[model samples]
Target chain A: MQTVKMVITGPFSSGKTEFIRTVSEIDVVATERKISSEVEKIKESTTVAMDFGRITVDDDLVLFLFGTPGQKRFDFMWEILSEGMLGFIVMVDSTRPETFREARTILETFKAYAPTPYIVAANKQDSPDAWEVEDVKHALRLDPEVKIMPCVARNKESVKTVLLELLYGILAEMEKN
Target chain B: MALKGNLRDFTITQLLNLVNLARKTGSLIIEGPTDVAQVTFRDGKLAFARLGQTDSSLATILHLNQKITAGQYRVIKERAGKMTDKELGLLLINAGYLSQEDILGSVQQYFIAIIRQLYTWVDGFFRFQPDLMPPEDKITVRLDLENLIIEGSRQMKEQEQLQEEIPSLDMALKFSERPGTNLRNVSLSVEEWRVVSYINPKNTIRQIAKANKMNDLAIRRVVFSLLQAGLVQLARPEGMPVAPVTSSSSSRPGAAPLPVTNKEEQKSLVNRLISRIRSL
Candidate 1:
């Protein structure tokens, strides 16, 4: 086992958990959800610690995806997660595109540790009210210089493209080093 | 959960209190789940406000919603998209007029930061510059009970406020408006700039909010102000990021970071911010 680590992160309800579930060959272990008096529905219980899952790409390529806690408080764990990690998978909700700024906060915090390669999955572009790609890019102010791949996370084709892009991003980072 | 404003997250009510308690002139940066805003102050009044990285079209929508002022719109337009929405939101709060509901709704592009308790920030975020003299031309504001509370509670958990917006009649006049400045002359509170410097083609405002430990609305305002100031430009210069999803910023080629002289410079930056805001 080469033991390459990958992290899946995004805003709450952005299908971060679902994305990992779809890709990982093993069952994902998540935190248990308990109901509170105020909010009746089962809100996705926050992953206070981490969400663990695994996938084997080939003979020796075992990819370990550790999903992180979405609430800002859990950010302290990122330093530990990114330590010796290969890269990350950044997910997004295009319909709620502006949420991307929160992702910037984490990246900025980790700037000193090391610049990791990551792929962006603009999840839910297939939604009816999704903001146009142009609008999303302009509003989010993504760097034009970087390669941004558009993908509908639920669709296998789109998901595959994102994986490819993420892999390329990792490769590009490796080449730069 | 707390979110980052600049680089720190404030509680939902703390932001509401910041809006109610802010007295100094200049931009109050408000960071929310999605967008950012810059609220300008003049003579300790809410003068103007505008979104960060916004153009005339989107700005008009914000203005129509009573989110910013005409003067602030002009100032922000002048700066272009350099300021991020977070910075702008913080500036607006300092100048007053922006309510937690309105700002949270806009920045997150969804309703977040629900104001529960209404007490003002008995302790507002303030860092004054003793080295730089306060401008003589402006009318001296008489510090009132609210100011006292803010000053008294500067380091406390969250300032107390009765309502999310201007809770009292006096606040309306107190936070009515002030001077203004573009990114160059007026700058972020050191805390405010910390987050603005992070936005790139890779991250979404929501993701940033989730990752931050401070208040999201507060961060949005700082980003908005930076966008207004032209200090922190966005990667998507024209429209929002066109990418379907935003990734982590691919460590772009290095750009020289801003240099800070000393604590005095920081204070001076805050004071200059106050002065220019009063001018507008």
Candidate 2:
């Protein structure tokens, strides 16, 4: 089967790993490390390396998903991971209004490195304080052509919708190219 | 005689508590695998901290925390050439980016953060130099070492438990055939949910850790807690080969047969790691 690399990336706690975990047919491989800093107050560990997962779609094609570490210190991992990627997904945590800038930074970094078709998944939309899709779009300063899908990453259906949206985007980009 | 020893012979936690309780004034210098750190104590309180090259600069921390933008960081870096870390912090305050209190708070946090990382090291050498004061020019942030000892020890215990429970990185995780006996009250965290979702019979703890962008210790802790909750169990014994799931040209090569857990093997690993650190 032909294999395509797809990257899922975002800032801290944006649900990139969770999204991949939700969709991956195979078990996801991750390199999580204990966070010694104040970030540990929020979460026990952070991704220092990359997250890997795979899905076999039909007999003809396979999708390999790689999730980048959220911190800048691991930006080198992004460079290594984005190589030969078909497309990518950028997730934004809607509830973390302050993190929009970081998410934008991640999106820009991915675009610069991959230059492939991509869509933004505004995750954690189920949270009470989660920004509206429109608000997230505004916060991220996304272009009109860019698709922003609000998703609850923990939900299988929601994660599937996000993946399908990216797949369609990839297909469209491939056709254009 | 000055107190000095390898960490294998003396626990850092005990040393910290001993100094704190004694109300000693000294600098505890710890040399780890790659870098060295000095923790200055004044009458039992952690007066200040200094670390070797591996420690991230204040600007880097600020940038990472998103307190400063990339442009601002570059400008700060260019402008603060030759300035000490303390001076750079003061500059941040003078530039209206951070207040004095904020800078002080960050200093304390930054020191504690490095100390937290140091606490994780199983091998290192330590020396307590008596009657040495912290640098007068540096920003001094005092901490109650006893409080730090309590917190650090708790975290260390958790880490120990994780390592003890999941000794081998390659152990596979499988969900229990019987659902955890107590169901209704047990709520899972987002991380737990992610771990649970990826619990295929074939994936080892190491692979799961990699896919989740987590270290073995973190993954092991999750798996250990799940086991305690009766949510998951080990699928295979240590050193057993799970069927290789990789195709031809796969990035993952088979795990090399690990050396038996003997003193010689450990000595070899330590020597290899030290050389690796030196090369870096």
Tens digits of lDDT, candidate 1, B131-173: 2222232111222234423533442332222123212211101
Cα-based TM-score, every candidate: 0.40, 0.40
Which ten residues in a row are the worst by lDDT in model 2 chain B?
B250-259
- lDDT for A158 in candidate 1 is 67
> Quality of candidate 2's docking, in CAPRI categories?
incorrect
Q: Candidate 1: deviation at residue A137, Å? A: 2.5
Error of 2 at A25 (Å): 79
| iRMSD values, candidates in order | 20.5, 25.4
- What does DockQ give for each predicted structure? 0.01, 0.01
